[model samples]
Target: MPMPEQADAAKSRAPSPAVDRGLTVIERLVTADEEMTLTALAKATRIPLATCASIVYTLEQRGYAARRVVGRSHFWRPTLRLYGLASQLVRKIDLSSVAQPELRALADAVDMPAHIGVLDGATVVYVAKAATAGFIQFDTYPGKVSPFNLTALGRAIAAYLPEDELAPLLTGLVGGRGPAAGDGSAAAFRELLETVRSRGYAVEDQEEQAEVACVAAPFFDAEGRVAGAVGVTGFARDLVDERRDKAAAGVRQVAATVSQRLGCPATALPRPETVF
Candidate 1:
């Protein structure tokens, strides 16, 4: 057998031409400002069409590339795999310990339930939660897995995600955010994400729960990437008009605060918008 040091050296090097080509394909896809057809990809990357097609198939099987029709043309685009891979660097972060106290504070400030969640696969898993006083029989808590395309907290995290990653997931949202599924579908949810991106937060507005409404904001980590999201949930009736506006602002403030605590650079605050 080869020595340990030799094995380590071999592992660090590009294993094969195929691996190098795969990475090149991903890089070419990701760096382009827009999607590319096979011909476009070949012209851009100088790779043979058959090889490019094979690379795309491999990438699709690995969930690294998806065909999208959300904003641009129906062509292959990069997926959240990059985000997921980058987040591995933060695996050691104790998010619950880092943000629990702030979550409690946010809940108290807004007089409602609050949650801290991180993306796991296609969902956001609640890692910490602070419910309002006198709450009982709650369905959401630590470890609750929510689909990223459905909940306010999920969209909050999704908002900061690149459009390439967000588009494919939105295509799967069926019943809208709440009971108003009649007009709400994939296209509407895409529009909603656009609003969230522009406003720097997300609003549920009883789109998921009949009686519950939520306003949420994304938080960045030390690397300046979205580490997670924080949201406040309350009765729909209680979160109307000024109360809703206040809650959205409060939630955003808390998220920014927590993000600063997580070592993100201080930045200007987001503009206020009502949960509605």
Candidate 2:
């Protein structure tokens, strides 16, 4: 047993139990597939009911979490505040800065319009674009966003997603009436995902933009998370057979180069097709 003074001093220096409880609650709600109730959160964190309630109230006040009341029981879950903050961090990333050279090289190698895009909700947002020197290419530009199921860029990222995560995404995209919604149902969607995974890239042949063809490959970050994707777009006729295959190889090569620069292991590289 220690003296009262010593025990009190040590307790004062420790981290706030309230803050620890709050953070643990946030993590639990964020990772949960379904909403959790106040009792559940308190039990999961082993925090006293009153303290958990107070922390949850504070989070709600800050718009970081929300609750749904059903009769006497209330369910709580994290809100999109984290996602909004994440987007702010993404803006600071300057993906185009490091990826410009690769984008340009891809455009030159593929002789088409090249773009780097990141997944934004159910859409893909183009952040960088390059065109073959002196060659006119139309339709895609920086800041443009397209439905995930309709763009090769989006599908590339989707290919690497776990089934649990991918199912809801594809279902949501379909619910939004994306152009590809008419193509098939759940089974067909699964097949599309399977094809993309097997090939190491996603191919869209005149699927989104009329007479336009595209191939895209996803790139990983230092932690091996899919950071974004690189893609080449061109006319349908120009993207057939050897041409399409070659472009796929080029896209994978450039994405791999960038991924490597970001510290991704060579073993993790997804090479769809070998250069002929």
Candidate 3:
């Protein structure tokens, strides 16, 4: 019962139904486990078949979706255009800001100090940290830099690097220092990285500091490359056997969450069982 002018104004401000249906179709295609036929997409979106076809065809023209012919039917799937836009948005965000809340959650869950670190040359630099209340804290800070082989955070990130990139880092660290417990030589360090890769997580058991231990897992970027690592540090006596396993699982889960937020596909992440 409104005036004609008022009704026209309201209609003009409303969202476009066509745009909404087009987005719905795109989302359905993107989330489908396999390429969807136009019929399947229409059924999933509850849009009419001809309308869905038009929407998909428009998407294909815009480089957002691709069509494949299988048998007698055509199947549609989302292209990398959406992923490229997502990658650009993620690149503009800060890694530490994205990881801070997850680190805090990890600290509370494990009752220890949790941290995020990034590889810098031959060292790993801590960029953010969260400590549980009433817990004994370690002598670490945001800017603390430790040799790559001496910390779980470093090992977690290094384990995923290609040999061509890892060899130089190992050479620099081992050749410039005396034999250490975890990194005695380049060969030994390579062996350790192999173990870390197999397990999907890394552990530092009193290797760097007395009575201190840490567990960490790597998180990747949209390009499926290791971007950084998340770790929890505590007393070695407290992080043993079952406790260590639990902490390792927690760290892996948190890292996976951060990776997904950074536009990494779920398929690219390590399986949960691999952490154990």
**TM-score, every prediction:** 0.61, 0.62, 0.66
lDDT of 2 at 206: 65
TM-score of 1: 0.61
Top-down lDDT ranking: 3, 2, 1
Q: Global CA lDDT of candidate 2, please?
A: 0.81
Question: Residues 199-252, candidate 3, lDDT per residue (tens digit)?
Answer: 999998877767888999999987799999999999888999888888998899
The residue pairs in collision within model 3 are: none
* lDDT score, candidate 1, position 212: 74
**Model 1 per-residue lDDT tens digits across residues 1-276:** 999999999889847877777888898888899887766876787778889889988888989998765565448888988889867846756777776776777778778888888888688899888887784535788999977766778888887777787767766664644663344576777778789988888887666657777788898876677878888878778888987777778778778877887778786435444332
Model 3 score (lDDT): 0.86
For each candidate in the order shown, give its overall lDDT on alpha carbons. Answer: 0.77, 0.81, 0.86
Winner on lDDT between 2 and 3 is: 3
- After superposing candidate 2 on the true structure, give the runs of residues whose Cα lies further than 4 Å from its correct spot: 1-93, 133-135, 174-182, 271-276
Q: Which ranking of candidates, highest TM-score first?
A: 3, 2, 1
Winning candidate number (lDDT): 3
Point to the candidate with the largest TM-score.
3
